[model samples]
Target: MYALNDIVEMKKQHPCGANEWKIIRMGADIKIECQNCGHVVMLSRREFEKKMKKVLKKADSDK
Candidate 1:
């Protein structure tokens, strides 16, 4: 399962030209940050699950 502070890859690239995102928060809703332009966005867990391609990095123990 994905957790906060995890780096994930999406199927499509963002407008800023990055496909990498960092999970900043989790729960009923999820927050993700773009690695390229420092953009932040919120999405539902189900929506995130549908678009998530893979987990590139796992969260740290303290994150």
Candidate 2:
């Protein structure tokens, strides 16, 4: 499961060559921001889950 502020890595890298993304929003859809370039993207929950490779850091863990 993912939560807002969670840092995750997608199976594929972003255009900026970054695979790390920070979860900014969550719901039926999820919003992620690229850690390298500050690019923001939105994807459906199902799609996001499918593409997600691993959870690098949990939002709560950072606290």
Candidate 3:
């Protein structure tokens, strides 16, 4: 299961040319932020599940 502050890769590319996002919040709904463009979007867990390709990496202290 995903948690807050996890970095994941999505199946689709962002308009800003980034495919990475940081999960900011998680519950029935989730909030994710684009790494390159600084955009934020909210999605349901089901939606996120469908869109996510794979998790690149989780957020670490160095990130």
Candidate lDDT (C-alpha), each: 0.91, 0.93, 0.88
How well does candidate 1 score on lDDT at residue 29? 92
How would you encode candidate 1's per-residue C-alpha lDDT over 1-63 as one tens digit per residue? 788898999888899999999999899999999999999989999999999999998877545
Model 3, 4-56: lDDT tens digits are 78889999999889999999988899899998988999999999999988877
Quick one: best TM-score, which candidate? 2
State each model's C-alpha RMSD to the native: 2.0, 0.8, 1.7
lDDT (Cα, tens digit) per residue for candidate 2, span 1-63 = 778898999999998888999999988899999999999999999999999999999998887
Query: Which scores higher on TM-score, 1 or 2?
Result: 2
Quick one: ranking by TM-score, best first? 2, 1, 3
True-structure RMSD for candidate 3: 1.7
Q: How many backbone clashes does candidate 3 have?
A: 0
How does residue 63 of candidate 3 score in lDDT? 64
Per-residue error (Å), model 2, residue 28: 0.9
